[model samples]
Target: MRASVKRRTKTQQDVQPETADVAEDVSDRIRATLAKAISEGALKPGSKILEDAIADHFGVSRTVVRGALGILEHDHLLERKRNRGSFVAAPSIEQAKELFEARRTMERLILELALGRASDADCDRLNAIIDREDAIHHGTDEKAKAELSGEFHIELARISGNGVLTELLEKVVARLALVMTLYEHEHHDDCGTDHHRAILDAVREKDLKRALHLMDEHLADVEGRVRLTQDHGDRHTFEAMLASFSPQ
Candidate 1:
């Protein structure tokens, strides 16, 4: 009878749905926090991820933190090791080049399609996004500017009216933002203004060829701005982690 009671207690403990739900909740929160950090450039590339520190910071169990880390690993934000703990992702120079090349190809295609398909309303919306980006750029908040700059491209993709291409562009833009944050040496002053204006003007003019050409130039400029040196040091992860503490 004693053995049966113990077995039943163990089974009940193992089958607790509430415990699983709570664990999932913690995992989501941790993942969001880390993702925000990466987006903000606080947790830079190659930074070490200490699970215990995150668990302590969030007041959650290490199990929950591990789950979150696993998700981030899948997202290519965090990397794991056999014995050592997880670390933030650091994109190589070759990877960064490949990412930009992909963006250039994909963005040109998007613009080529959008040149004729995008309505006046779509142009207006794109203009509005650029305005917001300008405000964010001039504001004292650098992180907000960074986020808005990335968002501007995503907004353009949405206006292109192709769901499949938009999704692909979203992922590409996210990776580009990560690369820019990790590898850029100097910030571009006209990051959001000139290229967007050119693209919008070409779209408004309904000149598909000109629009595509302008997009190529815009992407080339952006690619050129990134300083991709072969430094495999662990600074990226640390910087990304620090970026999460901003007011955003």
Candidate 2:
């Protein structure tokens, strides 16, 4: 009987690792689903995430759901509030300014690095992305345009052959998505593709000066579209009537 009891104990211990692995896989799937939703703008900024509902819908434990939400929070895709559940992060105007400033600096550096390292084939890859960016007309969802526009910058970072810069740009671009959603003027037109084409043309010609100049103007145009003026509010008013426009 003592031998049988010993065997039972060992069996239970052996099962633990498998159970843990299953839980981890479930957690990763949950994290990926939530991340994609946030990326695609299905979950808009300032929108609350219902943890219990997610657990129930996925047939998983709340612990697993929390684990997934924790990862998203780390990515700045979701913000967890004390005594409140997780919500999609909404960047304030101040945060928006900082993100754009950082992106402008990062992008210029990324361009310089990419120009030095990129092959003729790499330049062609960029042209292909621009081709895709121009494939759809204005009738499509604006989010699609933004997604492709973002891919352009991310591809550029990847071409720089620097993993650190790639990671940083990815995070900054993720946050910038939230910023654009919250603060862009209704009539603001995105002009990313044209600028990208010109920059790529300069790159292929090895004209770094022209490429850099075009990049600066492109960054300015992007930042100029966001309404960054101070407004009266408890946190953010979001009153369209009271919204101020940036200089044209």
Candidate with the greatest TM-score versus the true structure = 2
lDDT, each prediction: 0.76, 0.80
Q: Put down candidate 1 lDDT per residue, 6-91, tens digits, no spaces.
A: 99999998889777888788888888788777776667666689888988998888888988898889767888978988987777
Model 2, residue 197: distance off in Å is 0.7
Prediction-by-prediction clash tally: 17, 0
lDDT of 2 by residue, 17-109 (tens): 988888899899988787667766667776789988889888889998998899889988899999998998877778888999999999999
Worst lDDT 10-window in candidate 1 = 231-240
Native-structure RMSD, model 2: 5.4
Candidate 2 ranges beyond 4 A from true positions: 1-15, 138-143, 186-191, 230-248
